[model samples]
Target: MGPEWAILGATSVSLVLGAVVGLLAIRLQGIYFAMSTLALAQMVYFYCVQASFTNGEDGIQGIPRGVAFGVWDLSTDLSMYYFVLLVCGAALLAIARLVHSPFGRIVAAVRDSEPRATSLGYNVSRYKLAVFVISAGMAGLAGAVKAIATQIASLSDVSWHMSGELLLMVLVGGLGTISGPLAGALVLIGMATYMSELREWVTVVQGLVFVVVVLSLRAGVVGSLSGLMRRRLQAAPRVSAASLPGASAHTSGAG
Candidate 1:
């Protein structure tokens, strides 16, 4: 298994898993959808634990650092970094395209109003299921890539905590925005990587960050910024219109 092949395999697996989870989420909606996904992920975690190939507690160690194209060595850090970036970027682009498409709009509509969408002759549940599957597939892709990157797959990859962490990442970065999760993943992963000395306190730090974001920023960072930009854009046109010569006369006459 060359490094390129390994990465490709991991990415493909993650994409399928993400799509499956996304499909499930489409049906459940709100807290129900979340809980459903969490439960499903836990089932996977247990399965991995029981599976011999996963090595249970010890995890699948010493995974081969396969070569690149029979020419480039991926055992090196630089090559591996480039490979990860390329794969992740491709996945993100796919997600972005999905979000901007008509199907994506339908999914959003289902999120906003399933009953209304159904009334409009759309099979809301089916659409939701499809999207849930897609999201799950993407998540799986991420998991597979992660496993390959670390050259190991443990029960931890499918654990509820992993799912929770992903949710938190999206929330902190700004849900409903493509870039939010990427940013959130960076911050969370970076913190975890560098805070090895304070490993015991990492949980506390993470919890505090979640608390602050939930309390002070309901929309998450990106969402809040987007809202601010929209408000400013809207206000500019209003201000300009109001300042026009006939604006005050019209307002006074109406009054």
Candidate 2:
């Protein structure tokens, strides 16, 4: 199958699997839910490491960048990069739109106060499960894209460490914000790439950054900036049209 087909297949499979997992996972709350997911991820990692189809520890390598959409040759790095860029741009726009939609508002309400959401006749459990399934599908799609781009798939991808890294990205960027994940990913990846020579000290830097952000900016970088701008806008003095220099003169003249 081509890259497109592979992506579609991965999404479909993940959606189904996510639903199955969410059935039990969504019932747990807070730390229990996180631990449950971590355990599940560890199981998947072990399976990937032992499964013959996954090629054990070595992983599947030399994956071809099959033609995408029959129009674009994804074999070339330039073409592949542009394709990934377009996909990312579209995904970001979709996420923004989704977050502003009524459904998104309802989800937010559920997140803020589950009891209130339930009192309002919303199915909190269903919404949570739906979100989990959707997120899983999106993750699968991203994995497919990454596999195609890098021409390999590794067992480590299914490990809990990857999940921790993903969580770090969201927290660093701004949890519950639309653009936070992207910003976090870019920053973390940039740090890793540029500071490769720092060796084990790179992790120390990441830890320091995370700690500082948590202590100083509780809302995260983008979230804090957004809140600051909002406060400033509200604090700014408002100029009523009636208070203008010509307003009274014009009114008197009209009268």
Candidate 3:
């Protein structure tokens, strides 16, 4: 089967699990929501571990890099690379578009002040659930890509540690900003590649790096840089009409 079938599987998984979690979690707010969702995640992880269909901890492996739409051969590394790049690029663009759409604006509004959104007659819970489901589906899409690319899907995919790593990526990348995860991923992947020799210490070093990022770049790499640029732009002196080279002559002639 091609990648399209894989997407359908992922999408179905997301709709079922994500909707369930959203139903349970969306009514609550803040840490409560996080805890509730994580509780479900823990359940799912164990289910994956024990379930027969999931290969009982070993997971579904030996997945082939089949053709894309029966046209593009994904057997070669170069072809796979381009395929992944195209998929990722499209995902990012779609996410960006969604985040800027009116629906996104409403979601942001609901996020900032639920009471206000409610007062404005918005169905806060529905919006929260929709966004939650969409995000979960996208995450599933990522997992599908990783599984297909690596040709494996193991227990580690749904493990608690994997959840922690996902959180770390968001924190390192800047929680709400586009391109933040990409930068964070690059740093983490680069470290993993270079420090493969020190494999055991990689997690420790990652924790240390996370600590550093938390302490120093509170807004994250991309977020902090963008903030800095914005601040500089704001701080720079503004030029008045009187400061223009021809302003005096023009003003005198007018007078």
Candidate 4:
């Protein structure tokens, strides 16, 4: 079936489920939360395995690259790429705007200090739920696009290994920085693609890279750069202030 409408419907359902899951998971912290999420994902994977609609292990393949909105034809590679690019661009812009908004500030506050945010009368749970829903929706959107691009929908997308890989990308890129994921994906994906023949060594090499990054760039590549920039900025103001006092004293002495 070339029904692109299913993509939107699936995304919406996934987002709602994400919010519901977040509401339930919001109470758990640290390892407990991680385990709960992992369990839920595993359950979904089993369900997919049993579900007839998902076509069992074979998955839903041969998905036709039909026209988007019944207007723009995405059957061609160039057109499909541009369509995906537009969607990704819009998502990035939306995320940037969200992070700069008051709501985003509240979410950040909750992340840094839930107790403090709660004391300030903000429902931290709700904030987490909203953020979870947004993240889920974005993920679903990406998956949908990937399915369309590859002309298949497989269980690999929902696998635990995929989750681990995603976490690795975020950690290597920079947890809080917007550009971190992009850079990490570029580097890691490029490495994986190039080293596809050396499959056995790839994992070991990636692990070594992770160890090096953790030992040296604890804040992550982007985060470390951001910290350096901040320090330089602070130093600049101090240097200017010191120079101002010295210049004034020298002028007074000259007078």
- The runs of at least 3 residues in candidate 4 whose Cα sits more than 4 Å from the true structure, single-residue gaps closed, are 1-4, 237-250, 253-255
Candidate that would win on TM-score: 2
TM values, all candidates:
0.83, 0.94, 0.94, 0.91
Cα lDDT computed for each candidate against the true fold? 0.77, 0.90, 0.88, 0.86
Mind giving the per-residue lDDT tens digits that candidate 2 earns over 1-255? 678898889889999989999998999999999999889888888888888988998899999998888878998999999989987898788888888999899999999999999999999999999899989988888898898999999887888878988999889989889888888899888998999999889888998999998898888788988999999999999999899999999999999
What is the lDDT ranking, best to worst?
2, 3, 4, 1
- Which ten contiguous residues of candidate 3 have the minimum total lDDT? 3-12
- Kindly report which residue stretches of model 2 are placed more than 4 angstroms away from their true locations once superposed: 240-242, 246-255
Report clash pairs, candidate 3: none
Model 4, CA-based lDDT = 0.86
Worst 10-residue lDDT window for candidate 1 reads 20-29
> Could you say which candidate leads in lDDT?
2
Per residue, candidate 3 scores C-alpha lDDT tens digits across 1-255 of 788688769878987778988888888987987888888888988988888988986789888989889998988889889988988999999989999999989999987888999999999989999998998898898898888888889998887788888788878988778899888988887888899999889989999999999999999888898899999999999999999999999999999
> What value does the lDDT take at residue 210 in candidate 3?
96
lDDT at 135, model 4:
89
Q: What TM-score does prediction 3 earn?
A: 0.94
Rate residue 155 of model 1 by lDDT.
69
lDDT of 4 by residue, 90-134 (tens): 888999999999998999999899999999999888888898889
Model 2 clash pairs are none
